[model samples]
Target chain A: MTAQAVISASDLSLTFTTADGPVFALQDINLTVKDGDFVSLIGPSGCGKTTLLRVIADLERASAGTVSVNGMAPEQARKARAYGYVFQAPALYPWRTVEQNVGLPLEIMGTADAAARVKRNLDLVNLGGFEKKFPWQLSGGMQQRVSIARALAVEPKLLLMDEPFGALDEIVRDKLNQQLLELWAATKKTVVFVTHSIPEAVFLSTRIVVMSPRPGRIIDVIETNLPRDRTLDIRETGAFLKIAQRVREGLKAGHSYED
Target chain B: MPVTVVCLAILVAWYIAAVFMNTVVAEAKIEAAGGGLVNTLDISWSLERPVIPAPHQVVVEVWKTVFTVAPWKVKSLVFHVWVTLSSTLLGFALGTLLGIGLAVAIVHSKLLNKSLMPWIIASQTIPILAIAPMVIVVLGSVGLTGIFPKSIISMYLCFFPVTIGMVKGLTSPDPMQLDLMRTYNASGPQVLWKLRFPAAMPFLFTSLKIAIAIALTGAIVGELPTGAQAGIGSRMLAGSYYGQTIQIWAALVAASAVAASLVYGVGGIERVVNARMGVRA
Candidate 1:
């Protein structure tokens, strides 16, 4: 069966006015994310990958072009509470315990049985037994996991993550990437991830969207032909290396094209 | 710990010196020949009546004034304490309301922040003592009596710290946390109640403790003029007029204890609220 498009962006552009002049953060960005698809946006610094993610999440507005999520405008989708977003840092409320932080969105959405939902989400993120712990008491990776648990507690149809594991060490990043994939597989939720690491993008994504800076725009979209059942062993396979190499070449091309 | 111990040691020494000074003054008075003749040779730092009375003398006078004296009597310590406490509590409540209201307004409005911030800061520069008597006279002529004048004085002293603390707390959210909330399409009010208010709590508690102390000072200052019927300040004025040094010292001690207790109460409440929020630290 053909996959249904969950998010569609057409000719999206975002510009911000600064003291220097008007700067284009993203330009002519077009992409479609299929339901249950794992897509990664990768680029160099100032390439507007995070900006594109923010626009799609409706945290930031686009200067031009139209974007739709779940057949609704980004703002409408956001109001409907159809997306879960994880930021670069954990962003957990320092004052709240892990359970309460996780339960925050549910509380805001006015969902009943918040406690049960919080417990379930904590379990999903493998943060069980840490419900009473405060954010500052947790390690960096644990804090990020708490944030993920918070987002998932609301059970949004789409998950948007902006460099969620970028602050973690390689060991933790690898582990979290695998866990994220496992989470996606189990929940069958569409994911739009942003990262600067080529290996991370190739390892986690079903499709990689490479972008260029200095007026950010998409340069290429490369699909992974690897099998759906992936594990730590998959990263060492020739197929994975080939896809990672292709992503690197696309990034190099992106750099030269911008120049 | 060492600093506190040193402070206590110094207070004990001061108390002993006050008692010795009183004895020396009394002995010199007995040695004088004429009924009103001054003893010039016994000039060993002994005044006819010491400005700072002995601690035990103050305690005995306080006990007599509080228990033996009638409410209508001019020397009743209990009456004075009641007056002061009433004014302090009223002023504290008003100041708390004003501070919280201003903080909320400043946090929510960019235009108000730009315009009113400088004015709020400027208001504190005018000393509260200078403003107190004027406030009393103006309010008195307008037929406002009792608590209103005193409460205004307390409010003047109490609001500044609270506003500063609350403003800082409200704006303390991290960039990532803010973006996360925005992505959820959280409304302004939702963000405030769920995020800013909780974050501002520790700061609010800190400000409240400070405000309470200022409120006590305001109440004492408010009593200094217009001959307050009851209050520690009024007691101090009466003591000065009659050379009743012990009465004044007792009132001062009472005020200090009350202030300390009020601050301690707020601290207790802070701990409970923080625990409920899972912010035990």
Candidate 2:
């Protein structure tokens, strides 16, 4: 009767011990992501949004409380290859061609049908005939797309993206945002995206988790009531503006606007 | 074009230096022969035994010894070059493999990193020239003559740079890249083969260039003090004993040529590897 929880966290905390002091990178984080749900962790810089994503991916350890991915411990889920993560940068190996870059995980895992999977994923990202081109030959946006293709090739159950389009120009960001929405709609894969842009969070996410810095905790969670097949045109609509305004208010309440 | 100009400038300077050095000897000989009229350049450049032979004299000597004799004959510079080259190649191959192996071990094991790196640095400070003869004599007493003993000395001199370079290379991948491999549940060897080794290619090639040059130096030095019957080192030694400055200079030129060719050969291999790995030019 209830949707299965793809990711669940309760009172999660992470402290990075630095030379100055113990930096509270994340604290008192509680959230639940359901199957097929698109959640955006929205925040300004130092908001622990990326830290939370890293915690779920088991790349960072929580100093307190517990988190489960697919009802298993984060480490266990990671060892099971339960998720695919797209970092802020493309992180494509410069020495590998586009096709080889996408196929890296498949080769490492020794999966059969690797060539077919690489082709299918590249096509899924609409990168069809640039297989032999090196990453350096592509533009930054294109390189990021290849990174996305790399993640999708693994066919992981969950997707974790950290500011995947943070460095792109506005026009390219808009285009990628639209392509990503369409991708989400087609695959129905659960995504937890981290971003600083309010409109981007509103445009792509079914739910937005607004966050603040000092101790790096959530400030608000706004559920966007928009059409499932949304378009960039929705950013001009009253419904989209209403959600965006609320996200702005939540961010303001956390004082993210101050220099 | 600039390189050619600099090289020509250096050759002119060398010629001037040889003339200045041999002028006193040439003047004294002319005076002893009752002050006969002879060109100063000819007398200095064509001396029976000058301090530093003119570049042309060294070239002429090399041409005569290399082109005018059977390559297998001891009198041929080609024979001496072959004797030195065999040891250099053998030492370089062994040194490279040993360096890479040590680097991998030091990288994967903290104990080795702590215990081995300082010693490797210390090993280089002992002066290869001091150790070369000791190594040759020790190995020779155990009847390990020929190329193997010389190669061991070459290996000793060359492995330091390669080990240091490869250690840096293997660890060059940033933390984020390493984490990506971890998320895939990739095995250790998979991470190393797919990520670390490929990542270390540029460093490996750089180290190989330096190691090849050092390996040749090591081979030549190993030939010294042992009075080895062949090789460029022995040729130079015999030339010095007989006060044949032209012969010594010719052997020195041949040694430099060998070093340059070896470095360029490594560079050629580097280019092919970079192309195969899709590195942008």
On lDDT, the candidate that comes out on top is 2
Question: How high is each candidate's TM-score?
Answer: 0.91, 0.97
Q: Please report, as a residue range, the 10-residue window in candidate 2 chain A with the lowest summed lDDT.
A: A250-259
* TM-score of the second chain in candidate 2: 0.96
Q: Which stretches of candidate 1 lie over 4 Å from their true place?
A: A256-259, B1-4, B12-48, B63-74, B141-143
Task: State the C-alpha RMSD over the true interface residues for candidate 2, after superposing those residues.
Answer: 0.9
List, residue by residue over B101-154, the lDDT tens digit for candidate 2. Answer: 999999999999999989999999998888888888898899999999999999
Q: Candidate 1 docking category? A: medium
Backbone clashes in model 1, listed as residue pairs: none
lDDT of 1: 0.86
**Candidate 2 lDDT, tens digit per residue, A1-259?**
5889999999999999999999898999999999988999998788899999999999999999899999999999999889999999998888899999999998987889999999998998889999999998999999999999899988987999999999999999999999999999999899999999989999999899999997899889988868889888989999999999999999889974446
